[model samples]
Target chain A: MSLSDQELKHLARLARIHVEENELNALKDQLGRVFKLIDALQAVDTKGIEPLSHSLSLSQPLREDKVTEIDSRESYQAIAPQVEKGLYIVPKVIE
Target chain B: MDISSLSVKKIKQLIDSKALSAFELAGLYLQRIEKLNPELNAFITVDADKTLAQAKQLDQAIWQGESRPLMGVPLAHKDIFCAKGWLTTCGSKMLANFVAPYDAHVVEAFNRSGTITLGKTNMDEFAMGSSNETSYFGAVKNPWNLGKVPGGSSGGSAAAVAARLAPLATATDTGGSIRQPAALCGVSGLKPTYGNVSRYGMIAYASSLDQGGLMAVSAEDIAYGMNSLVGHDERDSTSVKRAEEDFTSQLNNPLKGLRIGLPEEFFKEGVDTDVAQAVEQAIQELEKLGAVRVPLKLPNTSLSVPVYYVLAPAEASSNLSRFDGVRYGHRTKDYRNLIELYEKTRAEGFGAEVKRRILTGTYVLSRGYYDAYYLQAQRVRRLILQDYLNAFEHCDVILGPSTPSVAFGFNEKTSDPVSMYLSDIFTISVNLAGLPGLSIPVGFGREHLPVGLQLIGPHFAEAKLLNVAHQYQLVSDWHQQLPAGIAQV
Candidate 1:
């Protein structure tokens, strides 16, 4: 689980977070240390045990296919960094 | 008497009896915040205009003969919960400018109960840090000693209540965020069973483990407040559908023949001597109140920190993915493309601790490491939960020190991640097991700072935990003891 600088950069990219050269060494060391702690989970034999995604053993409840929420697009989009004509403005995706 | 010295229940009674107007009490709280927030760094934002307007409306309703138990009692919210039109920074640059457009279910619940929102309290960046130092706003100083940290990410809430900036505060617990801070700051906080409190509009850190709770002066006050907090919300699919029960109904339950399990693991070498003594003395008082202390073993206790670090961060990584330069959070000032925008925005927005966690989570959940770390942690989490279930068979509730030590000095554990992670050694297991746990000011440790006694209970046992804490509080004055400048100020 020891993350090299390259591996750390890969993870940062995968997580969609930009990492500068100065910050990479620190994050690489810290994330590696955390992973080492997490490595303790490996010693326990878990052959038959079911992994729990949620604490409750209850089955997930399904809801009816109905529209329960009102559209508040204007309020929701008001805080976006860049918006124009009721549409969020981002860098051009296609040439 | 100064309104600052009164408890939430007492304030409610006076407001109901017309002895005090909600407006005046709100003004007193506002004044206290203005006076104390600079030293304590508890409240990140306190809008006097918004607070007084809400109080005036509540006063108007009183004139119209409408009253509620929590009516007009000003309360602070952890910056994590979204309250429409308030700055909802989860102690990060990411949401520093993001004012929530809608209310979290918890906020709406308090709003429904007529409670006044004083402002948002400081917390760790996305509820990640054990010490409050990780907050973007600044570290919350413990009121007991200004140099010591109020534990986080609910640090601000705990410090606010301890300093009497507000009578109570709403906090969320994920890996001991609520209880740890409450313990350090010497107040009472409860983390209700997972799925009990609705998570809608609560900024998610670890979806599976985060549970909203409250920090107040007493378990009775939290219990009184809990009735409004725990409700089924369709919006949050994880919300459990359970019959409404009064969390305070059994506050006077006699502790006679109650089995209080003391897990040998919790009292081991890692715990400070002073903390152990305070907890033992509190357990002795419980014995006097008819509780029979029982020795028990939760063998998998040591695995809690490792398992929680894996799972919580895994969930955090996935959950935080939504914060990419889009919808309502901080976006980088310069970016050439959409992908660049996403990366630069997140890197700039998140703090170092948060970025470290996101990196940790991404590493663990990545294609190669998923089964080894993520799956293994989940399996171990089940074992941790089973250990508690087994212990509960021999005892009514398990009791131990809420934190391994009292509030440590600032910058003490910051450099070492493992050291900081161990701060949550006692409280993380409860979230892992999906059970309810509470931290109460059992006694003071070094330098007269608070040491909390954690009471862990089975799933959906909030009422019993509250009852146990209430009975202990009735026999003791620790929960009543406030930091030096807080009392009758």
Candidate 2:
């Protein structure tokens, strides 16, 4: 159940985290132990068991087709890292 | 007399009787927070101005002849809940400067009932850790002994209530976050059934497992909060549509012929003898109250830790992905590209324990491991729930130790993640079962630290659990025992 450095980096990328060189081995060791612990679940025979997604049996409740919220763009945008004219400013991804 | 010593009901009664004003009561708690919070580090944010304003509003309402169950009672909220105009950090560096623009459903419920906000208590980063040590704000000390860790991520709330800084505080349990701390700090906490309380605006740790609850001196206090806290919200789709219940109304339900199932698995290996003895004595007290003990077995108990780690983190990976640099919370000052911006902001923002979980979550839910780990854990979760249902056929409630041991000092289990995960062994199965579980201070354990006796009930059976807890509380003095230093404060 040992995770390779390459796999750790792959996980870090998928997780949107940058694993520094020094932190990689430590992260690998810690995650390896957790996976080992998780291995205990493998012994159970869950052949026909239905996966429980949520505790409740209800479907997602739908609301009326109307906007119920008051406009609060100013308040929300006030906390954004970078904003201009109420638009969130992020790095340009495409030309 | 300090108002912090009174019960939630007592406080409301005095306010109703004109013996105390909401403003004055709020002032007393605020002064205590100002004086003692430096040593305890329980509160992350306490706004005297806003709290006083809330109390003044309640004062005006009282003057206008309005009466609410929680009126004029001062309380703290876990940092995990969003309250507009207050810093809701969730004990992480990421959201340290994040002032919520809205109130969570639980916060709104309290506000509607006229509860004055004392402050937001500290928690583990995004409610991820068992020990409160992982908070970016630094660890919260157990009020009983300064060197020990308060069980977390609701440690701040537990500590505050234990020290009588506030009468009660709002808490949430993903995997025993509420109950574990309640046990460690000698208070009562209840994690209601999934969907019993709306999760709207409660910062999600694991969307499927996280349920908001309360920590207080007694089950009666919890019922007082539950009256306002429970309701179906269209905003939160999972909010149960069940009929309303007066949780306090069932406090005196006779336990003459009640059935209490003792889950043999909960007291198996790894539980400290002292903790088990304390739990045994507490249950024996229930037996004296005429509860017939029924031995039950939840065979898949050991798998709960592994199952929860897989499922909770998988949900968290999806939930926390929204915390990219662009929106609210911390952002990277230096990054060349959008990908780098996302990576670095999160890398710097989240603490170690949160990153570990996010990474673990990402790993299990990643393309190849999905079926083997994530789906398997979900299947195991169902089996675990089935275990509780099967056990409940023979009994009305289950009793066990809330934690394996009492509070441990800082750095005791920090080096190994699995050891830390094992602390919630006895309590985790309840969350996986989606049952209502509560922790009540039963007696003192080794090191003179408090031990909690856990009582779990069928889903949405909060009133039953509360009634059982209240019956025990009526005869026990453990919940009434505050940390020695609290009296001087």
Question: Candidate 2, residue B321: CA error in Å?
Answer: 0.3
Q: Which docking band does candidate 2 fall into?
A: high
Among the candidates, what TM-score does chain A have in each?
0.89, 0.93
Sorted into a CAPRI-style docking class, model 1 comes out as: high
Predicted candidate 1 versus true structure: per-residue lDDT over B213-320, tens digit per residue: 999999999988998898899889899999999988999889899999999999999999999999999988989999997999999999999999989988999999
Query: Which numbered prediction scores highest in DockQ against the true structure?
Result: 2
- What candidate 2 gets wrong by more than 4 Å, as runs, is none
lDDT of 1 by residue, A1-93 (tens): 677787877888899999899987777677768878888888999899999888888777898999988999999999988888999888999
Model 2 per-residue lDDT at B323: 93
- On lDDT, the leading prediction is 2
Query: TM-score for model 2?
Result: 0.99
Name the DockQ score for candidate 2. 0.86
DockQ of each: 0.85, 0.86
- Quote the lDDT for A81 in model 2: 94
What pairs collide in candidate 1? none
